[model samples]
Every structure is written in C-alpha cells, then in structure tokens.
Target: MGAWSKVRRVFTRDANIVTAEDLLSLAREDRLGGRTVHVTNDSALRHSAVWAALRLRADLVSMMPIDVYRQVQGLQVEVPKPPVLISPGGSEVGIKEWMYSTQFDLDRAGNCFGIITERTGVIGPDGRGLPGRIDLVELGEVTVRAKGPQISKYKICGVDYDPWDVWHERQYTVAGFPLGLSPVAYAAWSIEESLNAQQFARDWFGAGIVPSGTLKNTSKTIDRKNAREAKESFRAAVSNGDVFVHGADWEYKPIQAVAQQAQFVEARQFGMGDIARFFGVPGDLIDAAVSGSSVTYANISQRNLQFLIMHLGPAVGRREDAFSRKLLSNPRYVKLNTDALLRMDPQTRAATIAAQINSRTLTPSEARALEDRPPFTEDQYAEFDRLFGSRSVPTPPPTAPTGATS
Candidate 1:
C-alpha cells in the first residue's frame, strides 16, 4: 500500500506532465479620456511567480503599429498610449471575427490588469485520483477609447452565435463529434446516406424487406453480367443438390448450401431493390430470382419496356431530342437494350448498352441493327400495333415509292 501511494505521489508531483496555461488580455480606459488600451496575461505562474502573461491581440493592432513602450502624454506610461484594440470588433469599419473581452477599469491615471479564470480536467490511469483545478490570473491592461460592442457587436467570420454557444452544439461526448454534423451545406448528404443505407440493408439483410423511400423494385438494379453470373451460380448450385440426392436419401449439407446461396442472392436483390427505390425507380420489375437466365430476363424485361416506351419509342417515331430526355428520366433503357440485343450480336449489344449508360446518341447503324433482330414476341408486335396504330407491312427490299417522280 505504501509503495503504491509513493508511485501515485511521483506521478501527481510531476509538474511538467500536468500544468495549466491560458492567454488573456486586459485594457485600461483612457486617463485623458481617449487613449486606447491593450491587455495580456500569463495563465500558469502565480502572482508571486516571476513571469508575465502572454499577449493575444495582434501586432498591427490598428491601421498603424505603435510600440508598447511609447507614450502619448508622458505620465511614465508603461503600456503604450492610444492603445489600438487588437480584438477586431473595436471601432473597425467592418468586423468579422470572434472577440473575447475581460472586465477592465482605469483610475485617474491609466493603469490596468486583466482578470481571468480557467479550469483543467485530465484523466488517465489513476483515474479518480487525478483532479482538476481552477486558475485565476491578473494581466496589465492598456488605456483605450474604442468599445467593441459600441463599435460593432460581437461578430465572427463563420460563427454568428456567441462563442459560448459552441458548447451547446450537440456532441457525441464519447466520440466528440457534433451529434448533428448535419450541416445546411450538406443538404444532399441525407439522400446519399439514405441511398447507401438502403443498399447496405439489402446486401446484408435478406430480400423482400426493403428500406423505405428507395427506388421502386419495378426498375432494374442488377447489372446484366452480374445478374447472369449470380443466376448461373444459383442454378448450378440447385442442380448439384438434385444430383447429390438420391430418392429419399437426401444429403442435408449440400441442400443447406444451396438454400443459403439462394438466400444470399435474395439479400442482394433486396439491396438492389432498396437502391432502385431510393432513386425513384420501381423495385418490382427487377429480376430478384434464382434462375440464371430468368434473373437476367427479369432485370432486362423491366429496363427494356422502359426503354422502348422512352428512347426507342420516341426515337423510332422521330422525337430524337425528346428521346434523350425520356432516357435521362429513366435509366432502365440501358439494361433493356442489353436484354433485347443479346438475341442479335452480344458484342455490339454490350457496346450499345455501354453507350446508353453514358447517354451518348446511338449511331444510325446501331439503331437500324436492332431493327433486323426478330421481334421479341408476335403478341408484343400486335400489342405495339394496337397502341401505336398498325402500319401496313413493308414490301420486300426493292419496293418502289409509288408517289416519287420517276
């Protein structure tokens, strides 16, 4: 017990390891009734100790610099006469900085000292043993005529409130962050955080349970390549389970793996759905299924329909400019074109798909090439005809224009 007490005393007595120091300024009122005052203080060394307080106010105090030892009337001025306020608020035409003021007064002859108090709180190993202390200091003041509040009120560059107001800014306390770091400048941050959060929930948590205010599931979320790959993996895993099991002698381990992978994929779907919804896209149309081709099919199907209705529908009908706006308003066209083009040339299809993502105009050849591909469905064509007014079927390649001047 005695040894422990000695160890504690050694740490406690180490003045260098723990000491308090703060700067303060004091200014005296004018003796002749119009001189400026400047104040300074040293936080640590006691009144009896040999040390002067540090001066905080700037050197170029006013428009011109005055030496502290200089005097205006020769009253044996220790501090300079006409002391310009280093603190910004004083008699300045314009002010933009936080200023601190200490209580001050001057006698018939201008003489001053700034009074200030401070507290120190530190914690470490001997936790409770370490205690905080309050310190008081008196600093010499300067005689000055200008008043900060009278000249300009307490003004600061960025902060508009009182310096003390900073204390009430909700803090985490543990992490020491303003709990509401949510600044007006970052208005879009909430949307982005919402976007990321919904995605994380979908990717990590299971599917079908999507976060609120996200894009709708009816829009595409999964990429063609990714959707294809995940679908293939899911299918293979499911097939492997079937092969591994014989009538009634089911191997539980592989079955569980298959089920787990499916669940994982489902979670990804939910995540995608969450993302889609956050962006104001429909979540229902995304192919969040286990079938390799079908997953691709679902994502593609939704995008394609949107594309057809948007860009292609307008572009084919001679609304090229509107077509772009339509596409921009809905990105589902990208994957939609990919799904449709897969039936033609996969390489060109990928290129065209990439083009759509960048919002670049498709070349004439690019657009016409898609026309050569067989229609996705006879029923789809009929539906299109019903909606867009059926056109007379075109004659074979060499047909002549009947109304042309031959």
Candidate 2:
C-alpha cells in the first residue's frame, strides 16, 4: 500500500508522465444489453449527426468577428482588439481557429479549458493580470474538481493547476454545480443505439450470413451428399460471376433485403433528430427530416434570425459574458458580431439597406461599411450627381408662422 501510494504521488506530480491505468479510468464506456460501446469524445464524433451539429455551430461562431468595446459617457465605443483576441493560441492559430476549438469543446462537453501562457502588464480590477495568450487543452486530458459553485482544482495530464491560472468557460449549467452538463454524456443512449445499428448493418453485409436465395429439388428427394455437392457447385459459380448450369428439378429464387435495410435506416434517422435536439441544432439545418411538419421561411435571413433568437442567442450571449469577465477589465466588454450569420441574398439585402437608409435608421456610410466598401470620394459623388440628381433633400420655400403656413 505504501509503494502504491508513492507511485500515485509520482504520477500526479509529473505533468509530462501518464500511466495506462489513468487513461483507462478516464475512458467512458456505456453498456447496453450485452454490448459495451466506448463513448469518448472522438468516438461520439463518429456519428454523422453529432459531427454536423458541432461543425455547424463551431464554424458559424468562428467566422463571426469578435470586438472589444468600452463604456464611455453612457455609450459604448469600439476599442482596439487586444493580442489575445487577435491571436489567442499564438501566431499560428488565429482568432477564428481559437474560437472554433473552444466552441467545439463547449458544444460537445459543455465546458472548455485553456492554459494562460501569456499575460499583459495591465491588471484587471480583480487584481489579476489580463491574459494575452491562451492555449486550449484537449477535453479528454482535463479533470476538474470543484466545491459547491466553485472549481477547487484542475488536473491536466496528471498535473495540478490553480483555477486562476486556467481559463475555463461553461454552459448548460445547473444550480449549485461547478461544472456544466455535457450534451454527449446525456445523449449516450441515443448514440449507442445508432452505433449498434451501423455495426449490425456492416456485419450483415460483410459476413454474408444471409444467402441471396435457396435451392431445392422438387422432382425427387436427394441424398445428403448430393445436396451438399449441388450447393457447393452453385456457390462457386456465383462467386466467380458465372452462370450455373442445372436441371429443371432445381429452382432458384432471388430475395430482396429492402425491408431489413429500411428498418435500420429509419432507426438512424430518428437517432439523428434526437442528437440534433440534444445539441440545440435544427434538424433541417443538418439535413435530418422532421416528421409531420413543414416550415418555410420568407428568406434565409429570417430563418437565420429564428435560429439565433430561439437557440444560438443564449449560448452566444453566455460566451460573450465569459469573455468579458475573463479577458477584459471593468467597464470593457466583448461582443461577437452576429450580423455575419444574418446575411441575406443580394436583392433582399439591398432592399433592406435602402429601407433603413430611407427611414434614417442607418446612414449611407454605415451601409457601405456593412458591404465592405469605403465612403464615396468627391469624384465619385460628382459622377453620381451627373448620372442621377443630388441625393440631398430639397428645402421648402420660406413659410409664415405655424398658424398661417400653406
């Protein structure tokens, strides 16, 4: 017992070392009926629906730009992005890649962790230095221990890290729980069902347990040796892709496996919908069919808006809040521009922009910025005036007092 304790202490103290026992303890396995299905982070990704849902959310969030803003004079103004926001994982990993990695982990495991590798000289209000670079750690390697509503320790690859030294974000949280609830863990049953169906299909086809058809002698009874000889001859001919010559007494009928195949396919489709629900993704977004209901959108923008409001909005908001608290100081916050996801077709976007400009809700310059164009120069304005008249509204003739105005 003393020797085992010493061995355990040595493994825990060394960050670079690991044992087979530690890895086996961390691996997740689900036993359904008589079979065991390994449910690790990588194995969960084998399911197509899980892959599509995670990819959709991660790709969308990563492409959207993240900006920092400061509150000044009761209004928010955009500020220069810090180093962390620009290249969080270092020069090789841009903000997009970093965001994608973190969002993927958050969607799958309901939490993400990173090591704060670099810090700026500027200190936040909490007396802690601001992080300049954060390198994300794999979810499998991290083990978290927490007190009520607070994390007590983080173990990554057998080494302990202080909570302050680690960057952590969580979603799908419950009251009095320090760690978030994992979608993958909750949907393990559905995943196992799908995986089992897939394996059965593979085995059914690969092993050739079910023959295409059966042969029988109708004219007279055949001896066991003759029957075996006939079966072997027929199999050899079929395997060689040649026709077997036989007498009229023998009959062959082909069988179709359509019904059997369809059963497993339907099971897979149902599993797809269940997985989509677990990840807060729309079934149609991942091409999974939803039964008995058809929804149509006037435009893609409206569809995107619906998804944002109903599903993705709260998650995005939570992420922004996390970023603000961990990466910025007081009075400064972070925002992920969701306009990228709400982009419409050219015609609809043009009409929307024109309407906003006409209603004085959006300026022409601001509209141009949205389209990634610079404001018109003097020469360009002159050319526009030559083709079309000046855009400025005309002034009315001088009027008398309000009571006498005509």
Q: Clash number for every model?
A: 35, 0
The candidate maximizing TM-score is 2
**lDDT (tens digit, per residue) of candidate 2 on 1-406:** 3433443443455543432233333323434474345665678899999999999999999998998999899999999988999999999899999999999988988788899888888796568789988989887778765544666678887889988889989888777656666788667778767886786676556654333677888999889999999989988887545688998899987564546554878889899999999999999999986788679999999999999998888999999998898899878899999998999999999999888877878888888898889986788878877878884422334668877844
Which tens-of-lDDT digit does each residue in 1-406 have in candidate 1? Answer: 3422332333244331211111111011123542112222221111111111111111111112212232346543334222112222234311112111111111001112221112123222323211122111122221111122121111222223322211111111112211211111111222223333444444335443212211112334667786676445544554333322223422222222333334543454444444333222233333322334332334454554563463234322222222122211222111112233224355656776556534545443455465675433578658768887983233234657898775
Ten contiguous residues minimizing lDDT sum, candidate 1: 52-61
Q: Which residue pairs come into collision in candidate 2?
A: none
Per lDDT, the best of the predicted structures is 2
Q: Per-prediction TM-score, please?
A: 0.15, 0.77
Over 4 Å off, model 1: 1-268, 278-406
